[model samples]
Target: MSLRTSFAAHRRTRARLREERAFERLLARAPTVESAHELRALATRR
Candidate 1:
């Protein structure tokens, strides 16, 4: 692949990883079953 495409792919991977970590943090701190379900729904929506 071209260097530019490789860089773009890397950026996309980084963004996804960051999002997953943030989601995990939110899941860990979820206050109730309802909120957890909401989080899951939002994640699925993405």
Candidate 2:
């Protein structure tokens, strides 16, 4: 594989990890049942 392709894959993996962390934080700090349900729906979309 090319260097450029590997770089692109790494970037995508980083972005996905960032998004997962953000979602985890959201779940941990979620205030209400309704909001938690909403977050579940959001996560399910992916």
Best by TM-score: 1
List residue ranges in candidate 2 displaced over 4 A.
none
Best by lDDT: 1
Could you give candidate 2's per-residue lDDT for residues 1-46 as a string of tens digits? 9999999999999999999899889988999989999998988998
**Residue range 1-46, candidate 1, lDDT tens digits:** 9999999999999999999999999988999989998999988987
Clashing pairs in 2: none
How far does residue 11 in candidate 2 sit from its true spot (Å)?
0.5
Q: What is the TM-score of each candidate against the true structure?
A: 0.83, 0.79
